[model samples]
Target: MAGKRGGTAAKERLSRDVIVASALALADAEGLDALTIRRLATDHGVTPMALYWHFKDKDLLLDGVVERVLEGVEIPSYPAGSQPEWHVRLLDCFAALLNALNEHREVADLVHRRFLGSTAGLDIAEFAFAALQEGGFGRTERAEIGVQALHNLVVLVTMEPGERALRDSEEEVARRIREKKVVLQSLAPERYPNIIDCAESLVDKPADEGRYRGLGLDILIEGIRARAARQLAEPAEKAS
Candidate 1:
């Protein structure tokens, strides 16, 4: 029995992929706070140095985990020549990303804590930049829009319900929605006329989780379109 156990231990070699995947599983099973090099070593039946061989420190390890989560997401690709408007294309991308983030709550939280400068993150950013350029945004404006879209996506995902409530009991979900509506409706109408007037819309039944996000993106796109039109007119005006 001792020899058999020793053989099994000897076979348990570590690789960078295995380490990163284990880290991701750990983060998903427990919260991010529980993820530590020591804990990882224990989980893998290895020494702390074994983990260090793959990741120099916690931050690097986290970056790897984040990249692993992001790898599951696909950036939306628009067809050449006859693509939708830039904002539509942009929304398509954001919608896909938001879906991906929502699927992994822990990963979304991690992404919220650390800016994703990973290769996958850069690729998504490049895609957004191209969309913005197609929309006629200046370099600075494109950068701002890309950053804000990501920020908005993170906020939307983070603020959503803790778990996948689609499979949850309707009674429980309805109770929670009613409670939220009561609080919003009870706010002093004098101070919050808009909130008071739009309570139903604010907390719609069978909640449209993407309602606010869609509306916000619409506003952003419209604003960008207006700005782009103004910029074009200004150049023509100067030429005239």
Candidate 2:
């Protein structure tokens, strides 16, 4: 059988991971729409039928995008005895995941839509459990909860809202802000005092639209830190 070729008969030399990597590269270079089994077959030097043996269809291929996005990254497990720094590790995990998401410019939209279902995401959750263990959490679920909170942070930082609106580049945001100045000035100062006061700041406060994302990340991490402290104190309250 065709399936048997890469399995028992061929000694399983080729790998699913390699196939996924090739697809990811295609999405990176030519945009996600350009990717097809035939294109991947040409890029990978594999027969079309061979590609099917791995992904079957473009839908499965997209799921492969999530797999490749996470690839080899593993969450740090519970440390024995001494406590592992919780905030640093959690931030590192988000940084790693966000960095990977930023690499595939084209397929990022697809990944944003559905990546939490993958095993790699689950491993990240497990790593969170390890952090909770350091914070005096006894059950595995507390760690999972910590990871989930951090995951929300990463998603907010990385995922652009709505079809990106094309004019999404930092420069584009500035252009829009400048263009909105007339509208801002039209408002009565007495009627909308706060808008009048912050109007100049609104038309590109820190400039460089990308900096907005960096600022948002700081806010998100701060929120996560506050939440972690609350979670830690909760257990103490229960015990008392």
Highest TM-score, which number? 1
Model 1 stretches astray by more than 4 angstroms: 1-12, 78-82, 112-116, 161-186, 193-206, 210-213, 236-240
Q: In candidate 2, what are the lDDT values of residues 15-50, reduced to their tens digit?
A: 677778888887777777788988877775656777
Q: CA shift at 210, candidate 2, in angstroms? A: 7.7
Superposed on all Cα atoms, the candidates' RMSDs to the truth, in angstroms, are 4.7, 6.0
Top candidate, metric lDDT: 1
lDDT for each residue of candidate 1 in 1-240, tens digit (9 for 90 to 100) = 997675455335667788888888877767677789999889877678777876899999998887876777788765687778777777777777777776666668777445556888777778778888987888998888777767777877666433334446877777777887899899998899898888766665326666756665677667767877887799899999
* lDDT score of residue 3 within candidate 2: 70
C-alpha lDDT score of every prediction, in listed order: 0.74, 0.64
TM-score of 1: 0.72
